[model samples]
Target chain A: MTNDASPNTQPTYYQEVERKGYSRRDFIGFVTMMTAFMGLEKSAIGQVAKALETKPRIPVIWLHFQECTCCSESFIRSSHPIVADILLDKISLDYSETLMAASGFQAEEAMKNTMTKYKGEYILCVEGSVPTGADGVYCMIGGKTSMQILEEAAAGAKAVIAWGSCASNGCVQSAKPNPTKATPIHKLLKANVPLIKVPGCPPIGEVMAGVIVHLVTFGKIPELDRVGRPKAFYSKRVHDSCYRRPFYDAGLFVETFDDENAKKGYCLYKVGCKGPSTYNACGVMKWNNGTSYPIQSGHPCIGCSEENYWDNGRLYERASAFAGFGIEANADTLGKVALAATGVAVAAHAVATNVRKKKLIFELEKEGKQSEQELKS
Target chain B: MANKYLHIHRLRRVYVWELPVRFYHWLNALVIIALIATGFYIANPLAIQSQHEASGQYTMGWIRYIHFAAAYLFFFNFLFRLYWGFVGNKYANWKQFLPISKKFFKEMWYVFRMDIMMLKGKEHMSIGHNAMAGFIYFLTFIAFLVQCLTGFGLYAPMSTWWLPKLFTWVPAVFGGDILTRQIHHWSMWFFILFAVIHVYLVFYHDYVEGRGEISSMGGGWKFIEEEVFERNHHQTPNPEN
Candidate 1:
């Protein structure tokens, strides 16, 4: 918690963060940027900056379960300093298997001490799905089941944040025909806890930081979706504000990944871009600080934000049907409907023609009778 | 003195479907068929197009135009139907459409059992649509409502202010335009499937019972047999029995 930045032989991680020429102004700017990325209104920036500047440091116990650890990788690479340094470092991350210096008993003690000392105060961030089958023997950390560890840590935590799709929705571990019976954090833990889901295969780094900052700043969990994702980040679909949306509207699309259309950056709907169905802010806030997103990088979005994304469909195949706006525009349906309309029109015309023919016959017969009478006279 | 022949009273026909109602029904049917056909093509054009390149090539664009035109008609028909449900006859009323009474469940059960029995060669007759068909009809009507809702929801993002607000719930619940479009597209299949089954069942039942059910929609009458009338013990008999 102390800023021991004396001109010494070794510059600490804190000193490197400051010595990289980040002044109080730069720090505040980062806070403002984070506020926007977190989808907080302009009014909340001041509070966020104040919280970052004043709060000593929230004690964090980052647990890695049956996961790929990509969430941790994504977190450290956050574009902003307040995210990369302050939240990750200044937050007093007491224990993390991948990032922590201590090991074995020393690491275990640090986690246990933090939980006991900062009970009901420290933040608990779970990074993977926990397997509940077979007494949780599927995943073991230091001879203890992840379920036991998770419960023990979550019981004393002030707030619980499921850091990735693995923890949030069980990811591929809980896909169809799942043998391990993997369970998400929300499902494993009792419902009353304030659980925030940051779901993605590897969630956007800034989004991960944003959730943490929002919690630290407002002293409460952010608004979440029905699936428990933070609405601030998950409220909008990637397609809503995608740069390539005009192409989708114009009906221009990339037919294949290797096609010239792909280079042209046309919409990837034809090549199985799930942007139209997936909800996430990747297209707007973007990854690695607006540098590029999946679509921008010439790859279609696989809808990692959605639940059971891995099992939705084949990655290369387009969806059988698009839902919503493009409904009546489907070519086959339109053709059939048009043909049916034509049939109806023809039927109506035929009836009209028959009526006209009957009227004409009656008039002609009357005229023929009148002419006969004239001839007789 | 015994009369050689009895004088019979002629019944006057009453107007059941008004101009607007008939127009709406026929127009909706036309448009729905167009939408479904074009939608299927759009879903997988290559499947049908493989037969003949020249014919299939020209059809897509024309079909799209027809589809959009039908969609507009469908939208208007929906609006009119919404209005008519309140102002139209007792049969067309909103109350008639919603099954809110115990009799509805009883009717539904009877219709379900009758349908099963009929499928197994047991003959049963009803004056109006049998219960299962009635329920399906009601379901199709609701599906149309959903189609309109999801359709407009997707359309709202492209359109201007007030029109979009009407479908605000679409984006609010479904995460905006793209998702709304996906929902709208997928629902067309439901409509298409319903139409195919509906037409088939109408003909199937009519043929099996010799009821002329299909022609009743066009001609508005079917000849009832004296035997059926006597069996039912009704003064007036149902034509399509």
Candidate 2:
């Protein structure tokens, strides 16, 4: 690993934020919000502020493989444009297909420069899965397979951040019957670097910023849950903080998308809201600068953040009918049929037992009467 | 008149199920029934519309509360039974449930033939659980463990308690929460099937064998024929037969 910039050579994050015309108050506010989002106590705000003022901008290589580029769209459209701009600039994003202005050989040259310049210091942020099907011909960028590109980029990274569900849990590309054999970064990366998964269809923009800011502030990855998701935003379920949870507690649910209960803002559990099971920051953080989330907009959560949510069941089903029980058999239906069959079996068995018992009793009485008659003779 | 012809003095009373075993039985039966009813309701709650304030109604909350409460009872009750399997009387010993010997399998086959296949075979009698019934109960205990794991695993996110947190690995092993919940719900059905057959056999055996089998669970005593008891009393009691 080689470092091109000395500690004194590069401008710190605070200096860059000031250079970008953000007032000192704006910088502190953004830092405070990010620190809170990372689940740090208010007392640690000064420590984070000091770290950001002293640390140089970390070099980052943002890669795009087989994806819809929605993560980039969401990132650039972050509700607070300054938050997006400062964080993106603070990380010194060297190359991104969707956002970078370079094209053709120039873009490849820039990526190569960062990979060699920073060596083990640069962070590798992958935004999509790597397709390995048919020798990775399904997705090719610049004549190299996604697997080939990912391996090269990850070989020298300090840490890896899987930006969206596609990069984290293989979102829709790796759904059942995945034609491309799309593999998430964790499974495909040969590097043993620390990996963080921010899994959502398109993760909330502020959360993405928060993850980056936490890394810049702490000089390491945030504490992660068992599945490697940052525990701050991925610990609690959407249902745990949902405003409509009272409706669920009261047993009031919207039966359909366009019903009176829907108008009344009832719970969406019946219409297949996976909020109770899915873990994400959508409920508390909301989207688009805390305006509203999908559940708030009267649409059921599709459990986009959870692994294998696509194969769980129909989007509108309350419970998932797992494989091997057959497509038509959910737990309740299977249970009902099994109970019905047990009832029939028990009834038939009872009849047989009674018949056998009566015949045996009759034989015993006949022997008793014959023994009495023989005693009389 | 037929009552006089049948000898009433041919049987001797034997203490079988201990007080703790009977207590565990009835408590377990009650808790399981509560869990199944409330569990199904939680999984598929019927629409209970309220024209009043949402805060005024707590139908689903109460049901969930009852379900979780019963689940705790079910878990601890199962643990108590597991402990009792080691310390309880011979009739309730853990070894009785394990099919460890050739004789155990032979008696299990005899029971299946007479009770299930309805073949006229030599009567299978025991002062305690028959081998076939005991082994099935053993399997049911395993199901109990699964239910506890999955139940707590699903509840872990809502809870910050350490006990439930310990079971977070359960869902991870099963893949995810949806699959974990599916298994938890499926175990409810297994208990349902177990209950139907268990109740049917208790009454069936009591009537056919002329022993107080059903009442034995209630009063902790069973009437064993004197000759059969005497023959087996000298040897280590083979509860299998």
Top of the candidates by TM-score? 2
Candidate 2 lDDT score at position B14: 84
Candidate 2 off by > 4 Å: A1-8, A89-91, A322-326, A356-358, A361-377, B1-9, B234-241
What TM-score quantifies how close candidate 1 is to the native fold? 0.71
Whose lDDT is greatest here? 2
The worst-scoring run of ten residues by lDDT in candidate 1 chain B lies at B1-10
Error of 1 at B163 (Å): 11
Model 2 alpha-carbon miss at residue B22, Å: 0.7
State model 2's lDDT.
0.84
lDDT (tens digit, per residue) of candidate 2 on A1-377: 11356435677888888888889898888878877888889998998889889998788889998789888878876766666676674447788887777899988888998888778888899999988899999989999998999999999998999999999989898998999898888998888889999898899888888888888888899999888899999988899989999999999999888989999999999999999888899999998888999999999999888887888777887877746888877877877888899999989988877787676656455545756876999
- lDDT per residue, candidate 2, B110-196, as tens digits? 788777887876563567888889899999999999999999999887788998888998877765686687788878888999999
- Determine the iRMS, in angstroms, of model 1: 14.0
